[model samples]
Target: MKFEKESCSVKELVDDLYLAHQLLVPTHLRFSKEAEGDLFIYTDKKRLSQVITNFLTNACKFTNSGYIKLGFKHLRGTDEAAIFVEDSGIGLSEEEQEKVFSRFFKQDEFSQGAGLGLSICQGIVQNLGGRIALSSKLGKGSRFSVVLPVYKGG
Candidate 1:
């Protein structure tokens, strides 16, 4: 891992991710326009891209009709910020959510992944001084949030 954090344009990062996977979703599916103005964050672009793409790819795989949103926001009254992956797909139960990030944990054995994406995401976020969170309800959908501190002075 490069593990380098430097001043970088968030817009560039977002655009890259969008271009990389936008076509993978079924032609009829559309990404939500949830991204806002560009904001800089000191971070490793590669790892962050990996994390975001992992979330997006998983969401797209499970979602067939509704939208998937990827966006960033600064927590109100705080320097903390987050990148979120929200999807309208089969949601998980509390018991399932507990092991969502565990190695080899798979929601469905027949799903395409090797069960390493979320576990890797958690590690990457933790190394970046952030944490990955999930909020979901069975039969509704899931939202995965990766929270981190904004750079004070990179």
Candidate 2:
């Protein structure tokens, strides 16, 4: 798929996603944002938004309670910005984390949806010339992060 890449504000995208998914947070869960200022990146907004939405949706679904935080910031001296979603909910084991991005992979068989979200997200990030990362521990929580090149000048 061809992505319509462009220079866009990371803060704006985070704000939009936060607003779009705020009401969807479970009553037992609290949502927050860690993005402070307007950081810019050169990428496809719609595709990146999809990746983030998937992160938020999974965070809400797996998290029984606690907080889900969305964050974005520049990696100092790296010319890249990291966008991440962290949840204090059910996380993955070492084996699970290794295969979480595989197509049709699901931690819970009973969970809804076809297990294609993360795989698609990885593809999207890669197409945008970025890399996606994940950190988690069983019974703790998980964090999904995507780092993209920051938008310099035109």
What are the lDDT figures for the candidates, one per model?
Answer: 0.81, 0.91
lDDT of 1: 0.81
Query: How close is each model in CA RMSD to the real structure?
Result: 1.5, 1.0
Q: Report lDDT (Cα) of residue 123, candidate 2.
A: 92
Off by over 4 Å in 2: none
- Measured against the true structure, the TM-scores of the candidates, in listed sequence, are 0.91, 0.96
What would the per-residue lDDT of candidate 2 be over residues 1-154, giving only the tens digit for each residue? 8789888999999999988988888877889999767788888899899899999999988999899999998888888899999998899999999999999999998999899999999999998999998999889999999999888877
With a 3 Å backbone cut-off (N, CA, C), the pairs that clash in candidate 2 are none
Q: Which is the leading candidate under TM-score?
A: 2
As a TM-score, model 1 comes out at 0.91
